[model samples]
Target: MIKNIQRTLIELANIHRFVMRFYREVFMPPYEFKEIIRQCYVVGWKSLPLISLTGFITGVVFTNQSRPSLAEFGATSWLPALISIAIIRALAPLVTALIASGKVGSQIGAELGSMKVTEQIDAMEVSGTNPFKFLVVSRVLATTISIPILSFYTAAVGLFGAFLSVNQNENTSFRVYFDQVFDAVTFLDMFSLVLKAVVFGFTIGIVGCYQGYHSSKGTEGVGRAANWAVVMSMFLVFVEEILIVQIIQAMRA
Candidate 1:
């Protein structure tokens, strides 16, 4: 068991190394622009509705849940401000990261894992086509490109949801609610939030490709890779968030 665990770790590390090298190679000659764009459509645009729906519902629920607590202390006026802080600073990015990790990360892992099991990747290599460059690089580039757009859409929809929820009790216009919301935002908030989302996207792609590429060539191995990709991405996303928040706090001080 210990040997198996150790070997798995080593395999994962090697996969990461290959992915990074492929990423470097990707930017070089004979760029696979078409494949990258196709991946963007698959990983980004297809996933937009899911991210937007999740973000909107989350914001709406958060506002509804927190209203009574704030109202009890006669703090109703702070609703808009708190909602903005939550979305712009933490909630928006965190939720969007989770969504991307599941959608993009799992898809990358499963797709590569399937190809690996079917020997298609080996076939590409034999045919003198760089499988790593064609597959891994395209997906990673798609992920990196897609995440920011997804976050922007999610944040906007989430704030809109918050507005709808606030209207449940408060009699504020959309403009007024948004004014309070955006009023609380600062460069520190936006910077950390956006930076974190980008990193989170990179993490999802790297980890997913790593697990899938190195998994043994079998259906069971493919399933295991897919499962573990989601698990590891979630863990990494939280770690990144904590580190980012600490850095932000330090900068503030």
Candidate 2:
């Protein structure tokens, strides 16, 4: 157990160094605009359908589950406001990031790990092409930008789904439901959620790229990289969520 703990600590230290290197390289000259755009398209556009579906189901399920308890307390009318706050402040960002970790994170790891094992990365180095810039930076940037947009999309779709669910059980009008929801949502709520999304996005991208870029020399390593990418990204998302919540609370106090 001690050995395992030591190994984990070493790996974390290495990851910190990798993050520092990424920050340095990302801001250096010769920005890869086209590559970044392509990655954004792949990460954002391709992930939308899945995000929408997940958010809709989450809203429907959450509404259904909470409705009974609220009804018991004669507070069913509070559904919209409750659901909106939950989704915006936590559910949408967390769920969306987890999905992206499994989808985009795994894809990044597998792609880069395969390249590593096949000597493609080495070939790029030999050919004087900056593989790190072309691959890692672009992907990280794409994820950073895409996640916030996806969070907004998820919140919107989730509210829509909540509307549908609420209408089925009650006679709440759309405008009134939203007025209740939006009235409760402060600018702090939106800003904090977006900030969380950005952090989650960065964690996913950096973890995925780090795993893939440093993959061992075998096909099995590619699978391991993908697995690690998803696992680490998800873990970091939860950790980040806790930290952000504490920070927000402290700020409020």
Which candidate should be chosen as best, given TM-score against the real structure? Answer: 2
Task: Note the residue pairs that clash in candidate 2.
Answer: none
- All candidates' TM-scores? 0.93, 0.96
Best by lDDT: 2
| 142: Cα error in model 2, Å | 0.6
Q: lDDT tens string, model 2, 154-233? A: 99999889999998888889899899889989887898789999999998999999999999999999999999999999
Which run of 10 residues does model 2 get worst, by summed lDDT? Answer: 244-253
111-228: candidate 1 lDDT, tens digit per residue: 8999999999999999999888888888878887788778878889989998998876798889999899989999998898788888888788888887788778689999998998
lDDT of 1 at 131: 87
The TM-score measured for candidate 1 stands at: 0.93
Give the backbone clash total of model 2: 0
